[model samples]
Target chain A: MSGATPMLELRGLRKSFGDEVVLDGIDLSVASGEVLVVLGPSGCGKSTLLRCAVGLEPLDSGEVLVDGNLISATARDASLRQRVGMVFQSYDLFPNRTVLGNVTLSPMVVQHRSRSDAEEQAHSLLDRVGLWDKRDSYPSTLSGGQRQRVAICRALAMRPEVLLLDEVTAALDPEMVREVLDVVIDLADGGLTMMIVTHEMRFAEAVADRVVMLDQGHIAETSDDPPAFFRDPATPRARAFLSTFDYRRRSGRASGSLTKE
Target chain B: MGGAEILFQGETISRLLSGLMVTIRISLVSVAISIPVGVVVGIAMSSRHLLVRAVLRAILEFVRVMPQLVLLYVVFFGSATAFGLDLSGEAASVIVFSLWGAAELGDLVRGALASIPPIQYDSAYVLGLSRMQTFVHIILPQALARLMPPTMNLVSRMVKTTSLCMLIGVVELIRVGQQIIDFNRFQYPTGALWVYLAIFVMYFLVCWPLSIASRRLERRWAA
Candidate 1:
């Protein structure tokens, strides 16, 4: 890779809640058009890392540079921060707004774009996500998968420099997870710069250009070859973490045995 | 005398209607002032600053603990002797009720805002919305829905509570009812009973619609 400024860079990021240190000093960077997937145990600060990077969580001591511009934790540069979009585990679409309104709100309100322009882009994004028909529907009316797709569309409406996905499918039903992940995988195919935190091993292996495993608030392992890393993790901690997932055995089977009618 | 006859005698119905108008004026003016002030205070109550929250909480509790009658007395009578600033009974009622309404509504606003999930704010913030934009476009709309029912309840409560103004010689609905009763005590004989009954219906007429609106909103939003 050339020595151009990394798309998203975090230097010595540290965060704590009260006395409990959730993230120790950590440094990481994602190159332009790179798809980096973060894997970790439940409390390993993977979500916090993404939150800090997006300025949702204040960092204890660190600097976040997006395209080489500093984003302070306290006084965030709104223009710089706008270039990073994030989707949460719970698809937090505005409950009061319809799907189309949710996607177009930021563009019209923050970006000061004309309503027609914003709605036009929103239409195409919703169309791309197969949700154009559900445009006028409130978030409460949609299924978990459909709401998640609208959320992805909402983030994409910003035309973010880098998008952060925080366990986007963790709240979905088993049958619904594949649909959300498929939309994300399609985004990866489109060469969007994304930093995703997920527990889905196979999806991570399929979509990640680089994989980083976090443990106890630190990066425990990094692998440029995700397939090799998934097959044979370099560290014992990563191996144990991957072992906890039953994805390999569960891949080709239905959830449970069914009795003959 | 018949109940209908007692109500019709000497422009009694007109007198009561004028008195009801006074009651509504006080309640409406108070509500109009309180809703906006209360909403602002409630937003302040939800602030992250320790001192701001504490100070607002103390004010909220003080208003909650003190009886509305006592507040009316303090503002009406106390301000006169203490501050040498005489206030009209209607003005005093307005001031007292507005303060009490704002405090109550502020607490309700605070609760409604708190009930919104933190993820809602996060989602707006990550989309590059400024704090004011997030509040106007996202938080306020959601909080307003949750706030409607309780706020309507407060309005009815204020309307009913405006009867307290009679004690300060405000000659509002209840005072007018008393005047009618005193004047017709011997002639109508049973006029006091009918007069009080009419007052009861008058209050019911004013408050019942407010409560119905509140319940309907609660059901619609809950669904």
Candidate 2:
């Protein structure tokens, strides 16, 4: 990889809700085409970090940058903020719109693209995610996995520089998790830069180029080698977090690649 | 003269029909003004600013607590005495009802906007849609579905509430019915009962379709 500027960067991020601090003086970066997975227990500020990164949550004291240019964490600059795309735990699809409408709305409305061009791109993105046939269906008609996939399609349609996933599969049923995760895995394989927050240990091990374990609003451990970190975490907090999941037993299956149907 | 003969009295039926038209006119005019104004106020009511929310809440409470008849009196009689404004009964009724309808519909709009989950905003914002664009394309469309049933209910209420305007001497439906009954008191003994029954049916005819439409929207959107 060339030694160019990082695709995304967070500097001295500090956030507090009332007296309780959620993120504390954290600094991180995702280089171009890197998949950096954030591993943490609930309430460790994983979701908030992603929210702040995309300007959904205002940082108390921090700067978020895209391609080395400072963007506001307060969401003052919308066009600059659009460089990042995010998918949430709950598939927050627009219930009033059909799948096609949801995918094309931003491009047509915000970016002012022609309807023909937007629809053309939307059809291709939906087709790639296996949702082209359901383009006319409202979000209420789709299953959880299908809805999440459409959400991914919606984000990808924007052609964001970096995509953020905030425990996107946490709300899915066990059977549906793989279908959604498979889409993320495919995105990673295609070299899309991403910052993912997840509890899915096996998928994290498979996809992460680097791993950061956050505990109690602080980065407790950072692993440049994901496989080694999974095998032997350097910090007790990181080890305990991994122990809660059946990481060892699932280690064998981590090597298996997901084939797109 | 029997009740049938009283009904065919000189210009009686035509007068009552015109009075019903007045009632429809007042309600329709108020609704037209209320919808757009209420929608704007409702969005303002959902603002995060404490002062904006508090002030709007105060206005909403005032409108809700005061009876429509009292409002009519305040605008019609009070304006004439206090401000030297000799507003006609029709104009006063329009002013009073528009204020009342706009306030009620504004509260409904605020609730509809608040009912939307915050994630919807996040979804739109991350896609680079401005706050206005988000509200228009994403938030407003979802809120409208939630807003329609209650809004229809408000329209029906406004239609029925127009009966109160006659208290200000609007000579609307009820006033017309009274004039008819009083004119035939000596000849038609049971004229009062028939006239009132007709007025009741007229009010029902105007309001019932609105109620049906409200329920239909509620059912379809609920699904």
Candidate 3:
């Protein structure tokens, strides 16, 4: 990821929700097609950072640049949204629409693609995520994992330059988590630029090109070698968070291998 | 027995039917006009400008509290006297009902719009949908589905309230019933009672389906 052009950059990004500082002076950048995994405890501003990056939440201070162009304001240019796709923790699919409709909406509505073309691409994307059969199904009918997978396809359908996943699998059942993570793993393999917020330590270790530990509204620790970072974290906060995983592993609460089918 | 024969009279029946037509016309026209007006007003209620939302909210609140009869008088007698324009009773009825329906529907729409989760808006924004596009493609479909039952309830309410137009001399259903009673007062002492009962049945026949439909919709969408 070194010396690559920064596809997404957050310079001095600051946000607050009425005295509770959520994100404070966060500066980070992702190179084109690099997968950056963000790890943190609850209320560490990980979700807020992704929300700010996509302009869902207004910034208290600072700038977000995509391809080195300013996109800092809460009211960003409409075209810029096509550059960043976001998947929410709740799977935020439009309940009224069919799975095909959910995946094809922005492409047809925003990109103004022909119905045939949008559906054609939508079919391929759904097939990629192994949800082609569920195209006619509504979000309500699909499982939590299926819904989140469809959401990922919805974001991917836009052909965004940078995809932001905010705890995408956090809402899934234990048995369902692997299916969604597999879809994400495929995307990472395809060389898509992604910044994911997750608690799946094993999956983060396996897939992330670089790992960032966000603590108290700032980047407390970052390492290019995710395995090393997991094995031996440099910061006290990172060590504490990583140790929780060890405890979970010892207690058999978490899977030791994310690749186990 | 005398009024029972009057019930079979073609003249009395036709008079009631024509009054029914007038009532239906007023209700249909008012709904058509008010729904669009309400939608516009409702969308405006969500505007970012504090003053715009505040003013619209104030007007809707005032309309909600003020009686329809009072609004009818204000638009009919008050406007006629103040502006020196001789408005027809039908025109006055349409105007007043429209204003009332718009106010009621606008509030329904505002509440429905508000009831949508904030995350939906965030999803739309991140997907690059324009505000109008978001409302049309994303927000409106879900909101409208939820709005239908209450909106149908409003339609039934409006249909029932068209009876009030008699006070403005619109000669709607209730007015014709009054005419029948007065004409038969001496010949058939029980005529008033029968006429009112008939009016009650007519209202039920027209509005019952709407109430049933609203309830069915609530059940259907609840799942």
Best by lDDT: 1
lDDT digits (tens) for residues A112-192 of candidate 1: 999999999999999988999999999988999999999999999989999999999999998999999999999999989
Cα lDDT tens digits for candidate 3, A108-217: 99999998999999999999988999999888788999999999999988999999999998888999999999999999999999999999999999889999999989
TM-score top scorer: 1
DockQ of each: 0.72, 0.62, 0.64
TM-score of 2: 0.90
The global C-alpha lDDT for each of the candidates, from Candidate 1 onward, is: 0.92, 0.91, 0.90
- Evaluate residue A217 in candidate 2 and report its C-alpha lDDT on the 0 to 100 scale: 92
Tens-digit lDDT string for candidate 2 (B1-223): 3476666778877888898999999999999999999999999998889999999899889988998889999999999999999999999999988899889999999999999999998899889899888988999989989999899888888888888888888989999999999988988877887788778888889989998998898887783
| RMSD of each predicted structure | 3.7, 6.4, 5.4
Model 3's DockQ score:
0.64
Q: Could you tell me how far off, in angstroms, the CA of residue A135 lies in candidate 2 after the best superposition?
A: 1.7
| Of 1 and 3, the candidate ranking higher by lDDT | 1
lDDT of 3 at A91: 69
Accuracy of chain B in candidate 1 (TM-score): 0.96
Q: Please write out the lDDT profile of model 3 over residues B58-125, one tens digit for every residue.
A: 99988889999998888889878999989988899899889889988888888889988988988888
Q: List the candidates ranked by DockQ, beginning with the highest.
A: 1, 3, 2
lDDT per residue for candidate 1 within B1-223, as digits (tens), equals: 5755789888999999999999999999999999999999999999999999999999889988998898889899999999998899999999999999999999999999999999999999899899899899999999999999999999998999999999887989999999998888878878887888888999999999999999999887783
Better candidate number, 1 or 2, judged by TM-score: 1
Provide TM-scores for the models.
Answer: 0.92, 0.90, 0.91
